[model samples]
Target: MKCPKCNSEIQTENINIQADIAQCNKCKNIFKISENIEDVIDDNFIVNNKPNGTWYKSDFNKTIIGASTRSPIAFFLVPFMLVWSGGSLGGIYGSQITNGEFNLLLTLAGIPFIIGSIFFWSLALMAIWGKVEVSLDNKGGKVFTGISTIGITKHFLWSDVSSIKEGQANLRYPGGKGVSLVLEGAKRISFGSSLKEERRYYLLRAVKSVMNKNR
Candidate 1:
């Protein structure tokens, strides 16, 4: 195999189960191989191809980074639990209201479940309808919320990005890790809100390195 970016001879440097990480000696382009190479390698070729992620070179020296959209386990589990708990609590509350037993404590207790239902439903809908991506170049980086018209209509270039910080995103019930880009003017924008801890750290390092190189 030849490196897609530099045309250098590709060699298998590491293997694990059905996937192997291949590296190019000339340009140091790395690719993840999961199946027979002959079929996967098309005319356009590719640079990096992780199972649920992507790292590739694009037109005009742009580097694209893709993270997993939704967790496979959370996709079904979250919605199910949200609907179940919301429905059960909502039904009980309704019953209490009818029986003249409604109280502040019950309403307060049900608020969390109602909020969870709304958030999980929104997340599931977004995953089903669109995808998220990040694009970076010599100038700056852009975080795209999703691909639909209603998804991420506007994107701002963070030219003053000084560093990227990693932390937990506690927006939803079972929040995951996130990465935030700290800018020069004390401005911050976060991405990878749904990524795992390790994946978020990896993205943070990758974006930080690219930003440093551009600087």
Candidate 2:
């Protein structure tokens, strides 16, 4: 096949192979080759059949995170702190009533703790659901979080991606094993966990194929 980006001929020779990736000496682009190649590549094409856009879409079949699993120990502490602050206020109020001395200063002391607890809870909830969607298309690529799309910061033509890096790392949560893609421009993207090693390798091959064809 012809290289999609440079119009160079793509020659394949099998070398040391990993579960998910292979090295191509011709144009030197490592990509993923999987069942989802069609879905990841953009449909739009130029007169020469080259992809025209900069975005790629990847749909993960596995669960990223669920509400049940995402709820950390800190989540339950919010209510506890609020209740404790309320109890402190009650204690101060009762002491003032019996002593005939109104201690307004002591009652206000719990306000900061209550506010801080609420803020912590809010942040934890946000972190639990936030996930990055890694995708590729004719336009190029994107990482999506909710309604926001984060574009790949490094600029490289599809021809420039040379290698794929695969490894595992502990993620913050939601996802466990990490899969990474190292492109020619030193741009890298990773996903998955140890539980999905097979899927991760498949994804690596699919990306390698795409990058090779593009380059």
Candidate 3:
């Protein structure tokens, strides 16, 4: 198969069946090759230069911009969880208000449900229409998240960041893996929490490469 980055022919000698690693003759990019490399190549199963809306690069420099690739599982799970949790919260809170009894334990127990409901709903919203833009450049890195034309932003200097690594996402059951930036003092900023495993791996590599280059 041709190298995805350079579009050059791959060398047979550089490809090892046992290790499943292939070094592109042109780009020198070492990548994992599935056992069915010929079939995958024929089917165009190689990672695309541009992975839809999840990743991009700037013209000035290799500034990597990553966004969450919406998950199909989130499409189904989020709304159901939202409705269930919201109903439970409403019922419990309403019952307490009507009875004029404030039970601390019940309230505490309900807090998790309430939080879970909001969190999952947010993931659903993100999967449908929400977007988080993560950019890494020579100066530092930035994260922006919001709906189209509206969002929140955060920026961190290179000095402020310790590293970037893969982490488990909050939206666990069906989809919950993501990559996170480890800030100087143990703080973390996570993104791509709903992406598939392959996408997450590519993203983690990109983030790590950029972070390493800058450092």
| Candidate 2 lDDT, 1-215, residue by residue in tens | 33334434445453323444433456676544343233234323211231222123333421111111133433554466557655665576667777889666875875676676555544344334433334455545533333133222333445445555565443433333344434445455443332234334444455554554444
Per-candidate clash tally: 0, 27, 0
Worst 10 residues of 3 by lDDT: 38-47
- Candidate 1 per-residue lDDT over residues 1-215, each given as its tens digit: 54545544565553333556666688776666553243234323333434344344456678766555555645775668667866767686877877888687778888877776666666766544444566787767677665354556224455555556754453532444344323333446656665545445445545544554465
User: Candidate 3: where are CA atoms >4 Å away?
Assistant: 1-48, 61-64, 93-110, 145-154, 160-173, 177-191, 212-215
Model 2 poorest ten-residue lDDT run: 61-70
Instruction: Please report how far candidate 1 places residue 5 from its true position, in Å.
Output: 24
Candidate 3 residue lDDT tens string, 1-215: 65544556777788786888888887688877873243224212223544665665655664755666476866586678767876898787978998999988889989888887877776677677766566777888787766775666778877777666666564453455443333343446665555666666556555554555566
Give the clashing residue pairs of candidate 3, or none. none
Per-residue error (Å), model 2, residue 62: 22
Q: Model 2 clash tally? A: 27
The per-residue C-alpha lDDT of model 3 at residue 176 equals: 52
> What lDDT score is found at residue 143 in candidate 2?
32
Best-fitting candidate, scored by TM-score: 3
* lDDT score, candidate 2, position 58: 32
